[model samples]
Target: MRKIDAADARLLEAVQQDAHLTAEQLGAACGLSPTAALKRLKRLRADGIIEREAALVSPRALGYAIMAVVMVTLDREDRGVIDRFKQDIRNTPQITSGYYITGDADFILTIVARDMDEYDDFTREFFYDRHPTKTFKTCVVMSAVKTNGALPVHDLAQSAI
Candidate 1:
């Protein structure tokens, strides 16, 4: 791993908050020349500090009004079943995110659909047919108080020592 100084940490924080910021703008914020700033940004990417950048899309605007977190518990303890489930869920676009967790559930899935009917159809056709197991769901994402893709680089830098 590359050693990141205070300047690099500041640059990372600034860019993560707004990737669209130009090198000159970022330089001004972090106390570096435009040329130096661009070089540092390139170095960060080369070091794998900055991953691919992407736009955050709203689910509501995209026709997916319903958001649900489904906890799936597999009947069998076989690893093959879990592997198959992971692959199947990856292929299914409705399941945005899935995690293999500990406790009562083997996997937790985050799903978004047009409405309850669509979610029901997905559960019946996709989930039920492939893996027959017990599931518990919680449907309350009333409001997203805080959602950020940015990581806390300052804290990470402090801890690196």
Candidate 2:
């Protein structure tokens, strides 16, 4: 892992909150000059400490009403089956996030749809018709108490950063 100072931590924390912030603004927040801040930011990016920046769009605004948590159990646990499932899931856009999980389900997926009908179609197309899966269960999300949050950079290393 690359070593980072307190200034770097502060910079990361600031940037995580707002990626569009100017070098001057970030420097002011992290107790550095604009030039120094930009240099540090560039170094961080080069070292792979800072990943891609993105804008989070509202699903409701885009007319997506339903969000479902799907638990998928595959029939086979072989490498070929797992690999193929991962590739298929990666190609599917409706399944936003998927994890090869432990416990009851082999995979957990976060899916978004316009309504129940659309969701049903997705299940029929992906789960039943295409893949060889044993069982699939879905839990619709009513509301999000807390959706997305910034990573805890400050708490990670007080001494180093």
Best candidate, TM-score? 2
How do all models score by TM-score?
0.85, 0.91
Backbone atom clashes (below 3 Å) for every candidate: 0, 1
Compared with the true structure, model 2 gives a TM-score of: 0.91
Q: Candidate 2 on 1-161: residue-level lDDT in tens?
A: 97678888899999988998997998997889999999999999999989778887777788889999999999888999899999998999898889999999999999999999999999998988888889999999999776655777776545652
Q: How accurate is candidate 2 locally (lDDT)?
A: 0.88
TM-score of 1: 0.85
How high is the CA lDDT of each candidate model?
0.81, 0.88
Worst 10 residues of 2 by lDDT: 152-161
Question: For residue 15, what is the lDDT in candidate 1?
Answer: 89
| Per-residue lDDT of 109 in model 2 | 93
| Per-residue lDDT value at 4 in model 1 | 83
Best by lDDT: 2
